[model samples]
Target: MDDVTRQKILDQIPVIDYIPKENSQAFLYLKRVLHWQQTNSKNAVLVVDDSSAARSHISALLKRRNFTVVTANNGVIALEKLKEHKNIKMVITDLEMPEMNGITLTNEIRKKYTREQLAIIGISGATSGIHSARFIKNGADDFLRKPFCPEEFYCRITQNIESLNNIAKIQHAANTDYLTDLSNRRAFIHNANHRIAEYVKRKVSYCLAVLDVDYFKKVNDNYGHDAGDQILKVLALYMRKHFGGD
Candidate 1:
């Protein structure tokens, strides 16, 4: 903090000195903030394998890295676990499971989650090249051979998760307006065209409208660009409130 800000906070300390530290409002607020950070900082990973040893080993490794781990014995249970745990960001599955193999699990997961939403990494003991090939073809972000070293395992997990995060960042930057934080013209056109195609394919009725802000140029001319930006932000909020679903 700068000197002014630091001194201002220091000046306020005397005002609350009479209160016990444990009962102080500032202390309680800080405690809540810290707790929230601790809770939210860890991304959850789902580990699926028929072998108990494999699940336990993977879970242990992930937990050591501060990732919250959920385990399942097979793909069926993994699907149920995914439904139960909404925080699960990634899945690491073994390919030789009984109920649903990792390939089938990856395909099923893709039906609901894009790679940006949830990442999948397949692991198996098989020496055949086809396992890794099929895993990737079925929406697995990456694949690892069984008995992977801790370094290799962690690297794969980190890379896949980072790839998903980077993709999400790129997509947000591409689709969002910088000033108003609303959908940009390119995003609107792309999405509208997609919806139009779908609606036409299904022979469904649809409506499309373009909204123009009147006197926008006048506002910028009269009040400066900053005021015009504020106006645009307010208009964006109103649109989000009224037409967000559409």
Candidate 2:
């Protein structure tokens, strides 16, 4: 960044009476934000609003925080934008719009994306809280009233994104084997059940096969546990190579 831009960002940090013992979280967050803007130029958060002013205001706030942003005037355009941009991680939609409303958009988006895959936040200028409830009931991850403070907006966006990352990490740990980095037994059973169900629905013929590693325990008894672990890793890789398709 240029010196002027760097100085602008430094000036935005809250002033305090004394220097912190270590770098503040705000400082660290801003630094990471800058890095993300540079590295993730293609990834975006989608903003949907019928009003041009609202779209511009929200898009500017996101860009100021160094988030890549995509904007649409309504839910229909928003869905089109999502199809065009595969890297969108979040959607912020206004409740009232032309073409399609926010609640309907949320429902449609949830049909294709899980909460773990994409986050959605609903915003509205309406007086009734029922709109917020409807947004949540339809699958929004969060709701914010219109005329919200930027601090609250930033917090909500970051928190939801963090939640998605945390959930993905938890699922990865649950499904993946530690040593071989392949799907563990739990994941295998889960996926197999789903696939088998689909095959049955389609009236497809399928068979499950079990292969035994001959004298596998003897290899461990003779060579060592490490050698046995290596053998398992190699077998996992071979299986992936030959039968990897879903």
Candidate 3:
């Protein structure tokens, strides 16, 4: 801080949150606080495997670590389980299931949901060269070879759930407009810029218009402000209607 500003600050507050020249420590503390707030809380998991023994063992292990566990016998049953228990955070699926296998279930997961909403972990006793590659390529976040130690299994589940939570928190912070649930200014500008660039590359003609409500000032004068909020909403709706992105 400059001398004048530092003097003024010292005058305003006798004690400072950071010592002079200790900005690095302050920044470190800030980052730690942010990470703590963003970490995902504990989660529920679903175990889908053809082998009842594997399913029971894995579920028992995860439950021991304080994770809620549910089981399904096949892909069809897994889908039903998902609908019934929407809180399921991750899936520990076995590849060689009877009715529906892990691969098919992963495809459905990628098509229907998000990575943060649900994480996939592929497990198999067979060789991993082919199956593991395919599992991860599809959507599985991590994989553990069968006959692994229970400690390793629990560690993987705990880490995956924690990582998913951090990602969800960061994504929310990035995509959400703090003032409203709609996309924030940063995201809006990004998508808008991408579209304009694509249009330029394609030699497409497009008109860019800026719209704000007239007499917005009067809203502050009359309705105790934030009245312009409705106008913005209506504008968003109209834009959705008129723009081809609709």
Judge candidate 1 at residue 184 and give its lDDT. 84
TM-score of every candidate relative to the true structure:
0.65, 0.71, 0.57
Ranking by TM-score: 2, 1, 3
User: Lowest summed-lDDT stretch of 10 residues in model 2?
Assistant: 13-22
Candidate 1 or 3, higher TM-score? 1
Candidate 1: Cα lDDT at 142: 91
Across 1-246, the per-residue lDDT of candidate 1 in tens digits comes to: 365654555355222112134457858645643443354335799999999999998987776556788999999999999999998999999998897999999999999999889999999999898999999999998999988866578667767766766797899999999988887889988989999999999999999777799999999999999999999899889988988842
lDDT of 3: 0.76
- RMSD from true fold, candidate 2: 5.5
Q: What's the true lDDT of residue 112 in model 3?
A: 79
**Better model by lDDT, 2 or 3?**
2
Query: Best candidate per TM-score, number?
Result: 2
The local lDDT score (0 to 100) that residue 140 gets in candidate 2 is 97
Q: Where is the poorest 10-residue window by lDDT in model 1?
A: 13-22
Ranked by lDDT, the better of candidates 1 and 2 is 2
Clashes of each: 0, 0, 0
| Model 3, C-alpha of 128: deviation from truth (Å) | 4.9
Candidate 2: tens digits of C-alpha lDDT, residues 1-246: 365654555456442112233558757766645555464445489999999999998987787666789999999989999999999999999999988999999999999999989999999999998998899999999999999867678778867877876797999999999987788899989999999999999999999998899999999999999999999999988888998842
